[model samples]
Target: MTEDTLRSVNPATGELLAEWPIDDEASVTATVERARVVASFWRELGFDGRKQALLRWASYLVRNTDELTELIHKENGKPAEDAYLELMLVLEHIDWAAKNAKRALAPKRVSPGPFMANHEAVVEHPPLGVVGVIGPWNYPIYTPTGSVAYALAAGNTVVFKPSEYTTSIGVWYARSFALANPQLPGGILTAVTGFGATGAALVTSGVDKIAFTGSTPTGKRIMAAAAETLTPVLLECGGKDAAIVAHDADVSAAADAIAWAAMANSGQTCVGTERVYVDETVYDRFLAELKSKLDNLKPGSGADASYGPMTMPKQIDLVREHIADALERGGRALVGGLESVGDRFIGPVVLIDTPEDSRAVTEETFGPTLTVRKVKSVDEAVELTNASEFGLASTVFSKSHGMEIGRRLRVGATSINAPLSFGAISALPFGGTGASGIGRIHGEEGLREFTRTHSFARQRFAIPGMALLSFGRKASTVAVIRRVIGLKHGRHS
Candidate 1:
């Protein structure tokens, strides 16, 4: 591909908005090497300096909100309003990281065991040198910043590779930060652009750690590539997340949350609600309310529309195939039929009474499509929810037993009466187990994720005969040690 000729085509109007050169392998390697050099300086600056720099970056984001949001909309094919929301959430994460980095990464005095009482023990989180981040296109700012901001605040220089589909937005993010903090080292936050090969190169590069957010297959590939260098990695992969509605749940409220979770950002969200399990008692009522809420949703490539075109064109066929499989397998379209899908935008698609084994129920149809199934009870709902390979995120909508059901579902974070809103809290650890990927970002866990713990101990006083070379009464010393342990921790006979 011609690097300089690369352009970001607006999915809305099929117009070329901007173009930039694709950073080649040599450029990527040089950037990472420079980051490693700068990381030494960034790490030595201590938490205060790093936190202030992050805060300044957050302020810059807020000040340039309009310009950034418009760029995001043009590049990602999301509504300008939704793009703004993504940017705002990213800023929130930056603010939180700056305020909490010291406490989260500071050393603490740990208790020494009785045998080592004369020594003082301390454990501290230290930076892991340069970090490589391979970000996704959806929620371009929020998703990547979850790793990038936290990594930076933890004192690790970052080399970020934004999704090839949204490279312009990524460039815009890095450029703005550089403009805001010109005093920082140039490589403190560097941006590279390319396809899978570029991302693969990043993973195998000499970075101490790699953080990736993408599909399950790509996540596996990243893990394999990281293994070549035995480098540590954090993978935030795909999810077939579900929302469970209990008998006592408020049907109208559940409907609203479900619609937003399944359709937001054109249903391109990693933690978006794709499957919904409703108690048979309120199944009919819940379906009615959900359909009514989705009735007025308009999906198109325009400013006034609720959602815009799919950022990735290939996803449209997948959406169509999933809907077709569900209908072919006796699934009923409660609100939107197959005709709802457009050339670029997919209108709201709500599948009701979908069979548990159908593609719509089992696979992740990352579109404005939701599969609703009626279950006998909350136990059944939980069972069906946990059956999927993905356990990224889920929701429980119940007035009396919201927390109860939320705990039963196997996922990273479960929201009560909400839809994937747990991600909004920077104090909460995000990421999933199982096929959803490993490790976490955000909160105190995020700060530690980018660091390695080092333990130090220093003897305050020297005791005679403690060293093996010292000449002493060894039999008497052993007897005294045994007696002391027996008097202190021996079980009563």
Candidate 2:
């Protein structure tokens, strides 16, 4: 990246994909102002109007899926199938948000207390005006659209700053929305491209809210910057995610799912499995099955590639550092080792007996690697899995106790007897409890996250002599109320 321009390159072959003039603070401010100008128009669109526009955008993307997927494959270096699947997830979310927005954010009546029986109360979810979304590159379309779709469905305009690595895809995303709805105002959805300065500019650009999906440290920095304006933020950050393979589990099925979960997208997923705790009774069998499944997988830019290269070239060094750290700390690798870390792609590296505190076991590796450990029982597995500072997502496998085990896990989303099922379900809210993230995306919780709770109280009628809200309160009314209150409270004990 030069000082004046940002470049996007394919990690698979170092092929230059696209370039753009960087969006600096001044330009970002202008973009935000444009979005802010249309804020009221978007909010006033109401549920039905906005839903139509959002659905059109979804349909447009569906029609142009081939173009977007090819771009994703070229820009982010994921296999074409994976790129298509990511687009499919984005469409599902957009459809869900459009169809469910009314139900999730509409005004609802609330019962007034006994003392205010003559009054009626109601609660409503109002859009937070313009929302600034800083997206990630791993699942650029699926992840950021999680924020963009929901925020727009809830009536908030969005100024999205996609990752520098996937800037063109981000541009395509915003442009697609505009193309889908040419009748709508321009600022309802827009894109600003650049690196850190561009994103930081958006954070401080006075947007009503910022929905960021990125690294934990970057999330902390964005949160701190947003704090200066007391701007509300929804942070979906890093994860050192773990999975448990139980003694009673189907070893074959668990192995297949965990292999994909750990290595897909070159393991750039925030909720992807990085660590595994296998029941000691089936540790050997599980390890063998897992290794067998991964043996058939390969990383390339080809259609048959198990996955593709790491989207960010710099992240390769970090993966190497983790591998070196684990090997030096007495861990043994069953698959690839330090030598597997290549210029573009790192093959699947599976480590066993890595110390619990080793960087490979504790940190967010963000690469195609796995750390497997054996635990005495499911109880021990749960304990070990929850020990990570990142409580983002996890998978549990047990024939009869999958749900039971999942409930005991500390992560925000848990997949029982499956891998990444939580992510596939549009109705499920996804987020973490600790260093993983701040708030949720996807589902009703996600819809409401971009809105503010507004309460309203209306007086139906005023009692002839009871003017409690007015300055004309009477001693007689107070006496009667005290007697009734005492009687009502005295019955509880």
Report the CA-based lDDT of candidate 2 relative to the real structure.
0.92
Off by over 4 Å in 1: 1-5, 466-473
Candidate 2 Cα RMSD (Å) = 1.1
Worst 10 residues of 2 by lDDT: 462-471
The clash number for model 2 is 0
Say which candidate scores most in TM-score: 2
**Candidate 2 residue-wise lDDT, 1-493, digit = tens:** 6787988888789888888889989999999999999999988989999999999998999899899999999999999999999988998999999999999888999999898899999999999999999999999899998899999999999999999999999999999999999998899999999989999999999899999999999999999999999999999989988899988999999999999999999999998999999999999999999999988788998878999999998899999999999999999999999988989988999999899999998899999999999999988888888888899999988899999999998889999888899898999999998898888899999999999999999999888878876688988988988899999887874
Evaluate model 1: give its TM-score.
Answer: 0.97
Q: List the residue pairs that clash in candidate 2.
A: none
Candidate 1 residue-wise lDDT, 1-493, digit = tens: 3644567788867788877677777888988999998888999988999888999998888899999999888889999899888887898999999989999888899998887778899998999999999999888889999999999999999999998789889988977777889898788998988888788888877899999999999999889888988999999999999999999998899999999999988999989999989999998899889988998999876777989888888999999999999999888898787898887888899887678888888787889999988899999999999999999999999999998888888899999987777999999999998999999999999889999999999889877755423465487777788889899889787
| Top model number, lDDT | 2
Steric clashes per prediction = 0, 0
Q: In candidate 1, how many Å is residue 344 off?
A: 0.6
lDDT of every model, 2 decimals: 0.89, 0.92
Q: For model 1, which pairs clash?
A: none
